[model samples]
Target chain A: MIAPGKLARLVATNALSNRRRLALHTFGLVVGIASFAFFLSLSMSVRSVFLEEIFPLDEVEVVAPRVGAADVDARDALNDDVVNEIRQHPDVKEAVPRMAMAFPASGAAMFMGQRMPFEAGGFADGVDPAYVADEDFADRFVDWEAEEHEREACGPPPERECGDHYYCDQRDNTCHKRVPIVVSRTLVELYNTQFAPSHGLPPIDEALEGMLASMLRLEIGLGETMFAAAMTGGESPPRQVEGMVVGISDKAMPIGVTVPIGYMERWNREFVGDEAAEVYSSIEVVLEGREAVAPFAGWVQDELDLSLADRQGERFATAIFIVTALFVMISLVIVTIAAINIAHSFFLQVSERKRELGVLRAIGGTRGDIRTLVLAEAALIGVIGGLLGVAAARVGAAAVDFAAHRWMPAFPFKPDSFFLFEWWIVAGGIACAVVFAVLGGLFPAGRAANMPPAQALSQD
Target chain B: MAGDPIIRLRDVEKSYGPASAPARVLRGVSLEVGSGEFVALMGESGSGKSTLLNIVGALDVADRGHVEVAGVRYGEAKERALARLRNVDIGFVFQAFNLIEHLTCLDNVCLPASFSRGKSPAEVQERGKEVLGRVGLADVAGRKPGTLSGGQKQRVAIARALFQRPRILLCDEPTGNLDSHTGGEVIEFFRELNERDGVTLVIVTHEQRISSAAERIVSIRDGVIEDESAGAPAAKEAAST
Candidate 1:
């Protein structure tokens, strides 16, 4: 046995002399540790986003129609009358009826008026504009209010202008008086070509702001007018109509053309017939209190005998989350294998320092003293590596964000948006690195303990 | 004037390997050294001279033996007790010097004392410095073992062995690694320590020239003692009278 102080000195001397080897071992450990940290941080961020942002809003109470369920008929779609009745229920605060009508042969034409097949769907709904004002709903659907502000500031066009009326569309992109219409850039281009000559509208190649100012002409019930006279086997109405463009919007409507419910009802009664207005395809409801939302939605589904589809969307999102987590776990496995390699390297180093260890033993070193020296070295490696790994991850995340924003502005690559960096992630990485290092040294330390002093002396 | 022997061995047998093929290194070997006597064990290689020395110093165990060093039975002693005996009752000096290469000469000397009970760092340092001064290595106390010559390292080993004030000193080919001149110097230091301190000394060697320094010389052949000679003309005269 050797004195601990002497043993420590010997160990330190050996370690220092063999610094290059130590550094190599440490480098391996650090890389493994850093990889683990980066992956774990990413996993945690993704999980948090899914749990706190997407899942909570979509999954907690909502239920969706099961896959392969029968297509809902017009009568079974919970008509406006039934929807109104459901809203009058004590639990229900407000219920908005939604109707989706498929236009089979009436496809969106190309800008050049050469008919390209475009199957379209019409979504009609009676919704309180105030429902759009709900903070939670606004936070989800319209993330920014600046677009709305810009539309408001621009006001209405001359032909459609009405005094003191803040006209707005469902997409929140366009605002004006008579009837504000929000259309996609694609739709605007098409409309410009179709009506430019007869209506004196601007060309499609003009800038968006200029096209909106000159080319946009609204046609009241264009589809309905064509459908009516044809029902009696008469000549169809002209393919175009004359109306003023009220305002241009920032985005296309998510579902269909967002006409006011009053306008839709008037069009149905005058041309498309009253029978078409009776049924709704969906409903957007708002409860007075968040606590009442679940019960009201459930009661509406049961009372109206309508299968809800919101829950299915939630299930799909959950599946996505599981897949993402699996990917993260696979990355962790790779990091763990790398860490094991680091441990193996450290073990080899310990074997190389056998003579030095024997000297310590002869001088009076306890087993614990040797173990501490090895462990200390390992811990140092882990800490250094962890810091480097974190820095690398941050750089990686920044690069991802930059490329995503540059290439796909519509879908910004926000690293922090899905995977946030947390303190525990860093701590976990360091702990893992250190633990790996110590574990790596265990076999070598044991071999050192069992070595005979005489043999060790003779070897040197 | 025969006093109780400080070290005693009776019918000690040491062998290596299993019973069937065991190589009996020490067979029925018995020897004793009186307190304060300087003894030398001389033998050719493979004669178990070093093995006997190791048993007496508690560095090894005999398979069948009743052996005692400083009143403790070596065969029946536990590991802790054996370590204590090795630390306090016996000190070892090897042919290779066996100094920790990273330590300064003073630290090498002070090592055993650091492991012993009731010794502070300051006291250990002071004692180590004193012994290094005695060994004429006081100037090189701050230098590492790699910096010292072979003679210096052996001197440091001797100083280390003596610093603990053990009851017995064991040396195994202490000057084997050094040149003839430096070997003579290290042997002179051993003679001085034994003569001045009255510490019992057991030295194993093959060189007949080094045997003259011992007070008594025991020669072994084939693991058995062949001859024993009394040391000094005065001790021989006294024995004759």
Candidate 2:
């Protein structure tokens, strides 16, 4: 048995004595590790963008079959009871009911001191607030009417200050109603890529997205539209409800606006009948994970007579996973080749150090000690090369990000950096380097250990 | 052969190459050295003297018959125990003075201690320095072997061999590469170690001057011991007694 301290010193001495050979062996390992880290980070980042923003894999949108479809029935209409039934399902994490505006409505907003009418009509829907609460800009996407009631209980007055995206009405000394609305990220992406270039508007950077939401003032006419005449013919002119863009969320409707359920229920009750307000148009069931999506969707179809609105999420997720795995497999092959290079380098090193190893054996070092010395030398190379490799990968990623952001066209879900440098990726790259290096050093260490001590004695 | 036997060999044999045609280096030779006795093995090249010395030092094994060093039987001992035996109970001084060229003289001296577990480096260093001082190369402890003269390098090798305070020292022509004066000086050091410390010594040499200092000389030729005689020092010591 050799002392650990002495063994380390000997390993360092031997490994460092031959700097040129050490550098050559380490270069191969570094390139392999860097490739591994870069590909894994890039694929993971792309997969995250696809699954999280483009088509969320954990949520399934359920809707009733359209009227007059084969085997359709009136009992398939989604309501509070259906929503509760789906929510209480063991596999469902959350089930948020959504109601579309039954009557025609239109909206206009003041932008850059000019009144701009929404030419597509107000195709709006309302959902439970929990669906968008985790968004980055969700701090203000609350129901103002419900917040006013909660504030009213705290005694209106100098003590109560207006919350974010709200205004204190001086005349009543109470928070007046300003309906908060959220637009989908898809709508923003469409405007950025399609409309911004033609209209000569500066592209909106996501860093200032919160400012974009707070600055827009939208006014929706309850029973009026540019597309059609009001359905409620007995209406005494259209009532206008003022709303503010509180945030943008992926959970919102892709081509329209979304508001808190309370606002939709109230507006629907006032404009249409109580029946319209009570029936939900759809329910977004958020499952525990991607694995739960299939079973939960099946349960929804079998028990509640609801079908998924789209199956694109599951398909997209599977495609991303396969692509990521393929890239990872390619990286692993590169690393294994580098490991073979390491083994060749070590074979030469052991051959060169034969006399030294034999001399060590003569001085009472056992075969195990000799083997450990060679392996420890290899491990040292691994640690140094692994650190350098990860750093090279980060540098490579930065260069790629810089080029992409500067030259690539603006598109949907285009991340600022294509690579995501998570902690595990960096650590895993280093660990893989070390494991491969040790595996490469095994046979050479054994060769060095088994060399007879008599050879050293017979020398000279 | 003046004390209890510390090294015993009986009909030991060794050969190399394939069994179809073997080159026998030692052929059923037997010898013994008492504890604290200074003996010399004198032979020509290919005379099996070095092979016999290697078997005595636990660096090589006999093909047949019994051999023992101190109290441990060589045939039955495992390699780990043999390594410890070579590290702690026996020391080897080679003719080439095979000090590692990259290490300082003191580091080379401490090499043996590094193999033995539980010895702190500071303690090893202190012992290494002491041995270097004993070999009169204390000032050269920090210098690499390449920078030293042949004499200094041999002294360093000797200091390394002495690092573990072994009871038996095996020298395979320890002075073979040195000048006459340096070789004589090394022989004097061996004598002093044997006389003052009572350390057992088995030196293989052909030099009559080196043999003159030994108590007895065993001459070998053609893989077999041919003659054993009391040297001048043994006769002188016997007359004094």
Which numbered prediction scores highest in TM-score against the true structure?
A: 2
RMSD of each: 9.6, 5.6
Docking level for model 2: medium
For all predicted structures, in order, the TM-scores are 0.63, 0.85
TM-score of 2: 0.85
Q: Which predicted model would earn the best lDDT?
A: 2
- Residue-by-residue lDDT tens digits, candidate 1, A1-460: 4456644554565556556765776666555655665666666665565444333332222123433235533344456566677668785556666444422113333333333333332532223233444422222222122233445433235544323323343233254344433443444444544545455544554344434423443433334334445652333232222223333332223433443344444344434456655555556554565466467656756765554545543554566667656765664565566457656775676566565554444434445555666665555556656666666666676666667667743321133343466887777766766676666666666665565544454434
Residue-by-residue lDDT tens digits, candidate 2, A96-163: 99888877777887544546678323479898787777886566777767743533321245676667
Off by over 4 Å in 2: A52-56, A64-77, A101-106, A119-123, A129-178, A185-214, A221-241, A262-279, A301-305, A309-316, A402-417, B238-241
TM-score of chain B of each: 0.94, 0.97
The regions of model 1 sitting more than 4 angstroms off are: A1-13, A45-355, A366-410, A416-421, B1-10, B31-37, B56-58, B66-90, B102-134, B138-142, B156-168, B195-200, B226-228, B233-241
Q: On a 0 to 1 DockQ scale, where is model 1?
A: 0.18
Tens digits of lDDT, candidate 2, B1-241: 4589999999999998899999999998999999999999999998999999988887777899899998889899888888888888888898988888878899999999879877777888999999999999889988989999999999999998888888999999999999999999999999999989888999999899989999989998888889999988899978989
Error of 2 at A430 (Å): 2.4
**True-structure Cα RMSD, model 1:** 9.6
